[model samples]
Target chain A: MHTEAGPKRPTTPVQKGLQAIPLIINVISANFQLNQFSSLTLLEFALDSSVLLLVGGNRGRCVWATPMNNIIAYLFKSSLGKKYIMAVTGCCLFLFVIGHMVGNLQVFLGPEAINRYGHFLQSNPELIWPARIGLLVFVGLHFWSAMQITLENRAARPVAYANSKPVAASYASRTMVMGGLIVVSFIIYHLLHFTFQCKAINLTGQDFVGFTDPNNHHDIFKMIVVGFNQPLVAGFYLLSMGLLCLHLSHGLSSMFQSLGWKNDAYRPIIDCGAKVVATVIFIGYSSIPVAILVFKFGKEALK
Target chain B: MNLTLKVWRQKNGQTEGHFETYPARDIIEDMSFLEMLDVVNEGLISSGKDPIAFDSDCREGICGMCSLVINGIPHGGHAGTATCQLHMRRFKDGETITIEPWRAKAFPIIKDVATNRSAFDRIIQAGGFVSVNTGGTPDGNALPISKEVSDRAMDAAACIGCGACVAACKNASAMLFVAAKVSHLNLLPQGEPEKHRRALAMVTQMDKEGFGSCTVTGSCEAVCPKEIKLTFIAKLNRDFGVAALLGK
Candidate 1:
């Protein structure tokens, strides 16, 4: 402790206690962490110690969380594996969205388009299940990589500041996670409503009077017609579609960028490509419910 | 110009927040964005109200202290300009601006517009640097850094550590930010010694940080204040691939 002041820097009880702990304990715990580490963690601890030793009290808080500062000074030696995993997983999700939109486009080809497509998929459930599993793995990897990125961003800023101004970020991009969560909920419910025939969204004839013919085998397309006809259900579907569109809007081009699809002038073209893709996917999936209303439950049917 | 500012007000690190409206009148449009805030703060102090809290130091935009999500855009929607460097001319007369903090699960709001960006430090700590330090700050001219390498390195180095990349990304992805950090250093001959090691460490740390995955939209670069190139991101991928497949 420094003692050359009007008010002497006294060793308080807390400081005294902290100082009494053996440096060996710190080293032992750090070593235990190192053993489980994927790479040498000594850099972070060592950097923290050196910064502490060099700058001491004043600059201490500013850099305490920046473990990146002491990283071995080159990135090629440090972070390549995670980058590849991120790019690969990102590409997978991007491709899946495109495939999903294509499958969804069947609805626009008319009921036979969707029903035949659904039937075809159902007949080949064994082949499709692996696709579903792939989707799960891709989504899982995407989430894992996302979580990793956020954590690194946090550690980059340690000292809490007093005043700040806003920066440039889009509503869709900023809320990608939130939109994703909403989309996830919608996906679960959508599967239940269409695939499993959960009968959750008032799919029966009671909700919309004329659709019932007890003798008819419950048709999936018919179920969809009933679902979207209800204002509340239809509204949810529309909203979900909007969210999905937003997700695709940012998600598509980002995948290209992460996968390294860029040219100075053509970059904007790729961006436009993503926008078009999102738009097509949005219009295609959304047309299903609207089609049901147009073809099945017309203005006369409601009366 | 007179403006109605809807500022998100949070008391501390642990609190739910809401938008509080305030009037900012007779503001000079040519002032740096933070200067406008100072005028409002001065008004608040004169009226005996607690001044609005924010973060800034080098108003020149080098330190990356000012992180503001203005009207849903980080750094007020300007490309390659930090909040400190942003001028108020971007706004028009009688504009109703909604100013808030960076909204990400990873970046937690502390007070007013400030949020915890510590996740960035952690990701960088996780493995954002090289492993070749023998205690020599080599002379700038010592290493024969090629023009292409220097150019690419400069592009990556342009990342000011602003969280705009994260805020700008839809999934709250730090890939662009992390990739830039990794690629900037990894592209040069100076970075060659620790290349593989750097890729592995940074990537692992990124996973540990709870950020969402990169779906690969250029939104991070699109909204980037520095306009950091996507090439760095590609370079990051290339390096990561090498580390995963070819790195010893």
Candidate 2:
């Protein structure tokens, strides 16, 4: 549809047939910036059309547009809409946390293994870049919805009771905001310590980017080993893990409730399962720092 | 028994409120909390002073008219009890007591310990009803509702709308109240036809009323005079999600 001449642009009959669809044409013509049209991948094209279908009204005068607009209004401007967003994003972040913990656990497999895995991920920009952007969007939406809910909650109770007392809400459930804020702070510090390889914040007085494994990949093994070898660093890591545990303990089950996946029959199981999973995650994550700091598992490799 | 009372004294919604201390003398242990208040207010009126004002109806627990936060606990923190049902025997003699109104932006305080809870009526008016034909009462057996379904509906229908759940919730959320109202109708055959519209409209009206969203904190259920379960909120969430996704 664009005037740009690029090899990546679709030329085959099937792709041309797919482009013949009027809705995609409408979305491309109506919404996207002029430059973005040339580089639109199949995934981007599908995602944009669906979003436009829901938001911009169907085909400019389609019969389904009214209900779609109402649904969009409900999702965007209502209390339950904010809740649905939080629960969905919270689920995404929860899955990411599990994946990250599994990836970090690979450090136990020794230098070559973990470094190779890191290299594989780092080298794939096409895959990693999209995943990274999706993750950033999820995090942003999660935190933004949380902030809106928190502020609205505060405004709902403008007058304070003289002697308010909590009856059944757990401490972890009550302190979600506080723990979430701390976890966010830890995420920033963690990205700097490892992902960015910023030496000044690592407190080791040595830059981590220069370190290389025998095969010349970035030595994630050595960086993690040296980083957590310091008691203060490991201690902070442990503390953040504890907060993460607290956050997940309530969040996991609460996510189910918010999404309407929870019911009275499954309440006990969901609640118990959440705590168990949270504890398992804590143990899995904390083991790495403890091994590096206390057991000196990888200290010999540093020399 | 004699007790010192520190009660919230507000002239009206537009004026500032404060605590005015008074001695509650010769209160019998068998008297209800409202009876004790009545005695105290009598003394104030005898002295030609402004008496404490609060809300109460049916002096029994079922009307859901009584709203008070005693010592920071809604409905005196008694399980399955409204403020009217809270007896003086629950308190110790020669002790100090604190009483406040149901505190929430939506349930604005009209006077001392009394609030304007008509916001709830407006919410119910939004979509809490099913369209029925005007006729003589239909035979109950016409709708073959199974025992389990009817019982479940009854459980949700137990909500008294006392506003205690709102008072007990830190966020002053009306989720439990809305959930109960929505579920009782949604589960029944009569309410099935309007289910999607009811869920969508009631929640929209609830948000419009400025109530906070549910944080899944069990505080509302804990202090609910009718002991409405927190699971109903999940039911509402589930229903709302389906209706919204289906564009109903």
The numbered model that scores best in lDDT is 2
Residue B21 deviation, candidate 1, in Å? Answer: 17
- Best-fitting candidate, measured by TM-score? 2
- Per-residue CA lDDT of model 2 for A67-130, tens digit only, reads 2235655675678988899999999999999999999999999998899999999999998999
Off by over 4 Å in 2: A1-69, B134-137
Model 1 Cα shift for residue B189 (angstroms):
4.4
User: Clashing residue pairs in candidate 2, if any?
Assistant: A163-B72
Tell how far residue A122 is off in model 2, in angstroms.
1.6
Q: State the displacement of the C-alpha of residue B20, model 1, in Å, after optimal TM-score superposition.
A: 17
Model 1 Cα displacement at A209 (Å)?
18
Q: Which stretches of candidate 1 lie over 4 Å from their true place?
A: A1-117, A136-166, A206-227, A260-266, A295-303, B1-150, B157-181, B202-227
lDDT of 1 at A74: 23
Tens-digit lDDT track of model 1 for A1-303: 945433223256544334323332454365475463333455555554454434332321333433333334223123333334555776777677668778876544545555666667767989899988988887776666556554554443432222332333445656676787788788788777666656545655443223333333234445455567766666788899899888777766665555455545667887788789788878877776776655554333343
Model 1 DockQ (Cα-based): 0.13
Residues B190-242 of candidate 2 have per-residue lDDT tens digits of: 89999998999899888879899998879989888899999999999999989
Clashes of 1: 81
